[model samples]
Target: MAAIVARENLTYKRWDFPNCAGRIVNMDEDLRAVGERIRSLMPGELSQRSLAERAGMKPDALSRALNGQRGFSSQELAHIADVIGADLHWLVTGAVDPRRVRIAARHAWDSDRGVRVNPGRAHDEELLGHVVHAYNAAFPDGPPPSAPLSDDPADMGATLGGSFVRKFGSVVESRLGVDVIRLPMLSTDYSLTIGSRAIILLATTPNWFRSNWSLAHELAHLALGHHGGDQAPGEAEELPADEFAAHLLLPEELVRQHDWQAMGEQGLARFLWETGVSTIAAKNRLAKLNIRYSTEVAVALKQSTPVAVRADAGDERGTFERRRAIILRQQESSTRAMPPILAEALQRRVEDGAVSPEDLAWVLDVSVDEIDFPEPDDSAAMAQAYRQAFENRPSHADLEAWLAANGKPAR
Candidate 1:
């Protein structure tokens, strides 16, 4: 078989579903089943063409088969399954089962052990299911059915995170003790424990609502049974369960009820009051929902929040993780520091066990300066680029496009 090849010297590999881990009856029929499974985990409104593009195939050809106008070859079917992070065997036979396939997919990201697993991870569809399943098992039927929000969205995020730690810590403490922290680090995210202790490190940044959402997502990773054992961080890297954390934290039902699809920046910001999610998280989630007005609606969703200009108890953690630093230093001898913003973003990714700081810094063309941990401040800083823009500030689209061109998240 001529295997599909990636152009960018991709450092990614796929793990075959374990035939022995579970009963394997048939595979061809299972392939269709797996395709449906992958589609379920994806956002609605995505084009078959785009999905095919991700799989490195011609869309017209894929669409024809998907629409049942033609038959898909076995290799084409397997490639589609792989691109969407589906188990080929499960998709073909329905014999491998979701749990076994999910576990097999999770193992693809493993690299050595210990802190080595912390960085160099990618998050995609496969990890998303693992995270969700793990959370469902850990919490059973969703979160502890809390009453709707009675406070501001920002306040709700903080209060909920604090409340969860206080209330659920006892239950989780047996398996994973809660570390209520205000890390000197720049990022506003927390982490799940590794190896034996299974300690869950919960941190908060200035945006209370986003911070709270992150905490919930981290908790979900633990409850979902995805973060423990010898499982390396790589398995969860593709779609850093954090994305799902935000979604599960803010249920789709509540979001749809608000008709957030029609809301503009101000309206969406106002809508956050009822949903209890921050503007940033809400926007990202909105993008993933694949609603009717998504294309046009994405215009409004692309709006940016002023970087939380503060340094306080739940803020001031500069971006960059301990593990990322080790990796970046080892990878780039000439580099020594990172810009404040990029550093923080990479840090959050690391805490979420997504990407390592060193790789992020290298990718972003920044070097890590002295390891200075500052207290969380409440003031947001305007970078030179912003200052130069004067009244007509650069749009989020401009930044995102730039980041895409530069191969990094918008600064």
Candidate 2:
């Protein structure tokens, strides 16, 4: 068989096998390149045999493919890509799809001994994919400005004010241009980055402090550029994110300014209330800074609840109610079925006929009937409008004659 090797678009190597049924084949070089890419994507602890088992391929077959003795079918490649959380297009073509959105989250993957596995990753990727698509379609110019509000966590925490817990999400959204969505069904928080823009999905819970920490943690992932399954032994990525969240939520400078070691449970409660961080988070932050509290104070702080903390902090009934109202409002804003910016964009797309109401409803995770779509103009009205606009324009012959009559000479 005569084989003619060629390169297309500098993407992949192709082999034209004219003598054998005229079917083109990928060159061995391309196959080896793809194998190398897949190897690079796999975690250090994940063996080829283990990956093959997870991807439902025979060990020998995978080994052969990896050695460039054979090529993987499209289905096989897709299965392997899913197993490793890789982009199949990138694996095959060695080119990243600019429109592709990558989601990263802690505790999404786990390694049991030497075996790598994904535990309870949930529907984060699928849901975030829909959001990203809707958002991109709605705003082709890309998401709002994504500049960092401040590089220093202490400045960020201080600038957000004492109500930073309630204001953090909005600040992240408006200042960082990160779309923050709070979903009651999500098991954990997720960060989805598309180019420079990012979307953070916060899992809603009654504990607003924990929710705030989760949001800040996800923002940390974005800032550190950690994508899903990119890090082996997930803890490597988690520690930094947690540290970032701690600093952002409870600035070290603020913590050091107060004598926390001597401040009993009441003062600890005050700190929690003021910083909007959970008891454990505050404790960890102190431990990280080597600020030790008495054993009695530690026990009291740990045993305290939000209600008890509020009361101990000397909040009056009216003040408590006001703060409670703010928390409720913040939760409501964060837990919207769809993010406001995304919802607006989707609505605009629907109005402009770029997207369907059914699609919008599906993306919003609501029934189509529940959505209020604008009344579309009648076809006759649209036709009339087009006809009027067309009638107002000069004809091609008239424009040519006018140009000939008043044409300017070249300088």
**Winning candidate number (lDDT):** 2
lDDT of each: 0.42, 0.70
- Minimum summed lDDT over a 10-residue window in model 1 is located at 306-315
Candidate 1 regions with alpha-carbon error over 4 angstroms: 1-177, 186-190, 194-198, 202-204, 235-240, 261-264, 273-280, 293-300, 306-411
Which residue pairs of candidate 2 clash?
none
TM-score for all models, in order of appearance: 0.31, 0.62
- Judge candidate 1 against the unseen true structure and give its global Cα lDDT, from 0 to 1: 0.42
The sequence of per-residue lDDT tens digits that candidate 1 reaches over residues 1-411 is 112323243211122455544332222333344445556645566677778887665788566444433344566666776665555654555543323312212122234542213231243333333333333333322322212222233343344453342233232333234432223232223343311123333232434454455445555554454533234344344355565565445656666776544654445544543344555676667668865544433554454432221111122343234234324322332222222332354455545544434444442445634222343344434465456677587678988998899889765
lDDT score at residue 106, model 2, on the 0-100 scale = 51
RMSD of each: 26.1, 12.6
